[model samples]
Target chain A: MQTVKLPPLFTPPTPDSPVPSVPFATPLPDIHVTLFRNIRNAVDVRNLVIKGDPRVPECVLINAATIVDVFQIQMACTKALLHQQQGIMRTRSLYSEILFNLSPTNNISDAIRQFGISDTTTAVAVVMVGMQAPPEEVRLRLLTLIEGEPIPLSHLPEFTDLPLINRIYKTGNVAADRGQTLALVVGAMALKGHLS
Target chain B: METHEAILIKQGAEARVYKMPFGEGRCAIVKERFKKAYRHPVLDEKLTARRVIQEARCLQRLRRAGVDTPTVYMVDTPNSLIYMEYVDGSSVRDYINSRAPMNDDDERLLAQSIGKSLAVMHDLDIVHGDLTTSNMIVREGSQSLVLIDFGLSMVSSMVEDKAVDLYVLERAMISTHPDTEGMFQCILDTYGKSSKGGKAVRKKLEEVRRRGRKRTAFG
Candidate 1:
């Protein structure tokens, strides 16, 4: 007589525990950036440019911590600057888009006006989005575009527009710590399109 | 997809959840909807994309309403994945089951919190399609319960829908927890008093229960 073997029962694992890692998709393109401080003529740079005009020299300042979180999404390569090569987001520079990225709303004009580079922007952080260019090459290009002193990212908090960011993202009551605020910001940005 | 690693957490029939590396030091939960073999490719993609968006949006709206839920970290529609905050907590089901002979007041407080959260969501016109203790997590340290898994959730305000939501929770409670009659009753009592339309909802819930009983008896 032939005997049939019973299949093993599927025991449900504890939902909160970590499971094994599966194969992932392609790796992110390498990114390298340099920060510049004491940028001269920021107001002049802001004023010389016309709205919706891409021909003017680009000098946009962005929040360092915020931008990093924005780029970590699986489909963010299309939206954030980290995935694009230099000169790709020229029409709406990466600097401006990064600012727009911070705002939960979709009004590009308001975002640009509030979060984009301003005359008061004395410090700037520049990162290679998805480009293959060397750091020195990119740094020189940025230096020539807007005159500034290269500074480390640590000094970014002193220069970041926290009040404006708070106003834009409506995260003032989220938490006192900057890290928690950043987490809230990341969650906000990720849920941008899904918000009812 | 790059340097960072995402450890698989659970693989339900609908999606595979993973604990992914998020902002420095913080970890995020990534829910990826794997392609279904039964459905057509295009249909599956569309359905998955829609569900991901719906789930993320619901969490966002709930948070805005001050309802306790996970914070969405990122939504990759093209990839059919939702990256959100990994809340550290134990499911109320396990919490109650393992820690039995529990404090009556604490249990009642948790049940009240669940009732209140549900009331708030209903007021906001959001429905938690699957309402069970398993889906509600009691956060570590804070001892607050958070609602998770919004894949089947939707925006609806119909009285029947609301009644059904509560009815589902009641049934789940009966089957999962021992001696939960008091807990479930407390939920209904608190829920009825929590909102302006709570009385109406309780009345409707009775009708739903009667209909459910009829279906079960006839079938």
Candidate 2:
């Protein structure tokens, strides 16, 4: 009789700060994040969002604005960032399409207008969703267009557009609990395409 | 069985359930609907895709209606897999069977909870086509009844549909626990008291039973 040995599968989460497993095909991609605290050229950015320059495909267009709430922006950019870093364009156009995903409605124009980058976006976080290159190189690339100081991801809550998110998700009357609100939004987002 | 990382938990004709890691610390139940060899490849793919999407939508709708259900993490259509929160609890079927229903107050509570949840779901016009006790899980700590599996569910506003939903449950109860009609009565009673439409549904249920008896008697 032949005996088959199964590999030990489950790993218990230790007390040592557990790193969230990256949900990607590629191994480890250096994620670069920059927080732009001040934007002197708000109108310019908004103009770039409204109109397009075909020469720069990845640059500003209708969905190219970075004005969405931190959470929504994070969700939209995460996949694109990962794919971009991996040099795989699964969802070819992430900028405009991702903005569309953020909104609960079917109106692509409205979604882009509401969730896309806007003129009022004073603080913006540029997160490298993929770790293809060095962090410094990714950071430098983001700074080419964005004008602001680089800050840590922990400072994100401060940049959260609460009222806008509440208005968009229609959870304005939700109780003043950040956890509950985020859960509701995440649930809504997860059920976006299929809502019968 | 090709057991690489995922542990097979359950297998049915339509799909296979596996226990897999969801995130760093948590586990998830992945229901994978494999391609059927008997059917045409295209037809099989379309059927599985539609069912997976439909089930996920029903789960979301149920949660929004304030009914307890597993949270859906992601729906991978191409793979025909639904990654959902792993609910750790005993099925209501086993729970009721092990404990003496006639003497236990908790059994009554469980019945009432199920009734109330059914009322809410019916009110939302969500008909749980399969309402067996096996589809409900009694949470280990909270004792809250979390309904699972909405693959066979649909939306309907008709009183007959709601009544039929209850009737399905009634039939299941009779089959699963032939000696516990009292518990089933409690379920019906609680369900009837929970909503205004419940009375009408019960009336329709009686009509359904009468028609069922007449067909059996004549045929």
Cα RMSD over interface residues, candidate 2 = 10.3
lDDT of 2 by residue, A57-116 (tens): 243222213233344444444434433544653433656655565666666777767765
Model 1 lDDT per residue over A134-175, tens place: 545656666666687776655556655556556656665644
Tens-place lDDT per residue, model 2, B144-194, is 789998878888898988888888888888899867777878888999999
Candidate number of the best DockQ:
1
Top model number, lDDT:
1
For model 1 the interface RMSD, in Å, equals: 12.2
Which portions of model 1 miss their true places by more than 4 Å?
A: A1-21, A30-40, A47-60, A63-100, A122-124, A130-152, A155-163, A170-184, B1-4, B36-44, B213-219
TM-score of chain A of 2: 0.61
Determine the C-alpha RMSD for candidate 2 after optimal superposition of all C-alphas.
9.1
